[model samples]
Target: MITAIVHIDVEADRIPEVAAQVAELPGVTEAYSTTGDVDIIAVVRVAQHDMLADVIADRVSKVSGVVRTRTYIAFQAYSQHDLEAAFALGLDD
Candidate 1:
């Protein structure tokens, strides 16, 4: 799966409305109203890279009250348990 973090900016009065709309999009897993430079953060998962444009450009950007968006693609993930799991699986300490 291809995962992306989309930071969304929306009309000040439409944060909740825009977040709800974005969350309903096919590829979006979740959307949150956040406190920071961006108003909302959306997690999007797609089967292919090209689908990103379809979900973000062709759809998300057109949502009513959405001002703009910035997308960041994830390359890897690390967690506290990853090391423990690797060790248990026989990785040499």
Candidate 2:
């Protein structure tokens, strides 16, 4: 799966509305309102890289009040689920 972390900039008064709309888009796993330079952070999961443009450029970027977006493709992911499973391989407990 291709994992995309999208940082969104939106109109000041429409952050929540924009985030809610983005969260409902296809392949969008989650959208969160956050602090700092970006207003929303959207997590997208897709089958391939080309789909990133379709999702981010065509869908996310066009959402109402979304001024712009920047996307980062994840090369590696580290999570507790992966760590726990690896550590439990030969352990009795």
Candidate achieving the largest TM-score: 2
Please give, for residues 1-93, the per-residue lDDT of candidate 1 as tens digits: 999999999999999999999999999999999998999999999999999999999999999999899999999867779777867895555
Task: Identify the leading candidate in terms of lDDT.
Answer: 2
What is candidate 2's TM-score against the reference? 0.91
Q: Write down the worst ten-residue block by lDDT for model 1.
A: 84-93
Q: lDDT by residue for model 2 over 1-93, one digit each (tens)?
A: 999999999999999899999999998999999999899999999999999989999999999899989899999989999999999998996
lDDT of 1: 0.94
Error of 2 at 25 (Å): 0.4
Worst 10-residue stretch by lDDT in candidate 2? 84-93
Error of 2 at 67 (Å): 0.4
* Runs of candidate 2 exceeding 4 Å displacement: 89-93
Q: Candidate 1 deviates by what RMSD?
A: 3.1
lDDT (CA) per prediction: 0.94, 0.95
